[model samples]
Target: MPCTQKVTDDIVWVGGSDRRLALFENVFPLPDGISYNAYVILDEKTALMDTADAAIAERFLTNVEGALAGRKLDYLVVNHMEPDHCAMIGEIVRRYPEIKLVGNTKTFRFMEQFFDFPLQDRCITVKEGDTLTLGRHLLHFVMAPMVHWPEVMMSYDSTDKILFSADAFGTFGAFHGPIFADQINFQVRYVDEARRYYTNIVGKYGPQVQAVLKKATGLDIAILCPLHGPIWRKDLGWILDKYDKWSRYEPEEKGVVIAYGSMYGNTEAAAEELANLLAQKGVTALRLYDVSKTDSSYLISDLFRFSNFVLAAPTYNNGVYLPMNALLHDIAALNLQNRQYSLISNGSWAPISGKKMDEALNKLKGMQQVGETVQFRSSLKAEQLPQLKALAQAICDSLK
Candidate 1:
């Protein structure tokens, strides 16, 4: 049985979710799984927007076929050339031999590299501001290069005021039943996953995202049809605001995210003590993560979310702990900036992890150190409690 949902009177969602996949892009962990979203427009000349992952290829094809209902697929829009969305492009061309593939020059360039299929005469090349009419609907092409991918582009439907965003407003969660953002508690359930998805996958392309957001400001968008996760038909500003802030490297909330690396729970104890002190000082939105246990993707997400950060780690062979070092390098690699951070380092022999951590953070842009670096000799002794309390007070003052 084919499962599908209607987005509008003439547009139907022909996407499917893959809950079995453990990781996305073979790097980011997907505990809630992920969704591969595609859409079909029923007009005089039918059009299909993107395709699903190969893991769900069979089920996705069934949904597309069911949605088409024997009608010919005249147009297949290639929004992003990423394999998750473009894996079945060859299969699509094989099924709809006469369907005109719509994409930009870069899109076709990547297509040839990814697939062996001959696309010489099958592709209809489009550029920025190019419009394609399919009966009552008109799609305006918008170039969004480097918005996570070089071949990424967006199609705007003037008829229904819908923006076929390639991957801008996407999240990392499988769709259970509802296919729209308004149908579920998006903020409570999907925001973290969405943040993780953006910060890890598309966070490095902040300037490109800002360029696309600037382009979108002139157009009137009522529905956001992304290549993954749920569709946006209501409270569009909620997600747009987040994108605006994230792309500009601005924190969404004034809070703290304490991430620590502990070999035998000493560093974690210090982190917990600071967290408790902050809580007692009325700091409510504190997030603490064990860097050894928690995935770096989630930490990166919180790093983008909160304005303040605290890193706790121990020295290993005169260097920063392995997991904490990895996290710090990940932060610098992502070009994270404009945030305040504090450090706590523990070592039985050499207490240089705090300085090492500070050096790692110094490589990033706009990273400000809060108070003094708290150093502990393997454990938080009574003497260091005052120093930890003072550091927590400094973090709280910065938040205020």
Candidate 2:
């Protein structure tokens, strides 16, 4: 164990892992160490928002004890049921047997499925437009269905004006000591990760997000507390503005994201040639993401901007490359519509990547495929030169 350290006054960040150790699923490595953020709100009654993983479970208890001092633990709220957030529930329940568990119907279902915890009949089940009062702090629970998980709901405080957003508005980095966003330069370090988290996890729930936003409009928000990364206290409006844009699937600009997976240089070569062709066709705003090397964050951030997406890859073992497949799965989950896409693929014997890629994308709505599937084999052959040129022209035509 690396040992735990306290980071903030009310927010005690309790984790001691280096950048390489990713404690949370899909979390980017932060140099300061990954903090499994579990907040202790000492109001008329003490309330804890989301517990840490099993490893940091002990430290989480310590933080709660420090916060409670003479008071007893009153409640433990699970915002997202993903194991990283809910893994320590059983232990916490054992320690604080009388502590009330807070969540909705979906939360209990997942709680049973994940650890077989007996919380359904015992805990407080809240629905949309419900409020729980803790002395001066009034906790309002809103139904945020499918913000990554079906059981997920977020709690907000009218007195504190804090939105316990679960995974929403989270950034990827070392869990900094200060819990507030004003203490860190998230625009430089965290915004990209937050975008990635949205695209990869919550993008499919755009409709639910609309509902969440509608409910949120009625309340005033000052601080946004997520299960991961720093809190948003400074420039709160900036984050809300970004979330509003992201949840609506609005692209930032008219650009193209050329993402592909290449076994050898041949598939990658075709991608490069396609990029040049797109440039020649006057699509100057081009961003190339090699799915094999680039992190999911950059890929997601690009997707939020470019209206057009292109995937190029070589058929591997009679299928698309795994990285490209994962990327496509994440993109499709976003339920994005009205985006034009092109495909370029290569296979030595049977070029199956293109066909599979097309099938994966065809599942998305309002997606227009450009021309025919451009094919190449082994290496970029002299015979295949014309095909790349044709593919370029097809992409240009789609942009028009």
Candidate 3:
């Protein structure tokens, strides 16, 4: 039996979810699994938007067949060349030999590199602003190069006012029931996973995302059908505004995030003291995490959400802690900017993690330090309470 849902009068969602996979891309942990989306449009000439992962190949093909309902498939549009969405391309071609594969020039090149299937003049190459007509519907191709992939593109349906975004507005978690964002409590259920997905996977290409967003402003888009997560039919402005802010590397809230890498609980204790002080000074929007315990993806997501952050770690072998070092590298590699940060370092003999951390953060574009570096020898001394209080005050002032 195929599990398919109606997207519109002429469009049907043939995507499925994979909840058994522990990690996404073999790197980021997927606590609730992930979803892969593909759509089938039943027009005069039936067309498939994309393909799903090989993990769910049987179910995906069944859904596509059910949606087609004995109609011959005419086209298979390839918006992204990533394997997660393109893994079943060869299978799709084999199943529907008469189907024409639609994509850009680079998309064909990547397809040739990935699969050994014979094309035999079954390719329909399109360029930016190219339009493909299917009876009453028209698809306008918009080039979105380097929006996480060099061959990524988007298709805008002039008839239905729908944008088939490749992975631009994708999220992580798999859907349990509803497929529309308005049908569920999206903010409380999936916002964190959405932020984590963008910040970790596609966060490095902010400028490219900005370019795509600018191109999108010209089209009157009513529905957003991404490669993952729920489709957007209502409150589209909320998600669009979030992408704008995130692409510009701007914070969403005036709050602080405290991340600590503690070996023997000293650095953790210091981080808690600072959090306490910040809360006492009316800084309520705060998040505290253990870098050694929590994944770097979540930390990066929170840092992107908040305006201020505090990093506290213990010196190890004359360098910053191992977990904290990795976190700092990710922050820099992601091109995060315009953030305010504070530092705390602890060492029994030589406390130099603060200096190392400063050097790491200084390499970024618009990172600003809010308070003096607080150094402690293995523990927070009685006299160091004043230093923590002063740092809290400084952070509070900067927030105002």
Which stretches of candidate 2 lie above 4 Å from their native place? 1-20, 26-33, 112-122, 277-285, 292-301, 315-326, 347-356, 370-373, 377-400
Q: Write the per-residue lDDT of candidate 3 for residues 1-400, one digit (tens) a residue.
A: 8899999989999999999999999999999999999999999888899999999999999999999999989999999999999999999999899999999999999999999998769999999999989888999999999888999999999999999999989999998979999998888899999999999988999999999999999999999999999999999999999999999999999999999999989889999999998888888999999999999999999999999999999999999999999999999999889999999999899999999999999989899999899999999998998998899999999999
Instruction: Output the TM-score of candidate 1.
Output: 0.98
Candidate 2 accuracy as lDDT: 0.75
Please list the Cα RMSD from the true structure of every candidate, rounded to 1 decimal place: 1.2, 4.0, 0.8
**For residues 188-303, could you state the per-residue lDDT of candidate 1 as single tens digits?**
99999999999999998889999999999999999999998889999999999999999888999999999999999888999999999999999999999999899999999999
Candidate 2: tens digits of C-alpha lDDT, residues 1-400 = 2233333344344432224555346454333445456677776777778887666666666766666676777888778888878888888788777899888888888888888656644689889878888887788888787777788899988887888888777765655455667777878777776776676667777778878878778889877777777777779778877778777877756778999888767778878888998788788989887899987656876787677888888887789888998888777766776678888887889988989999988888778887677877777887877877887787777666
Which candidate should be chosen as best, given TM-score against the real structure?
3
TM-score of every candidate relative to the true structure: 0.98, 0.82, 0.99
Give candidate 1 regions above 4 Å deviation.
none
**Regions more than 4 Å wrong, model 3:** none
Better model by lDDT: candidate 1 vs candidate 2: 1
Model 3 Cα RMSD, 1 decimal: 0.8
Pairs that collide in candidate 3 are none
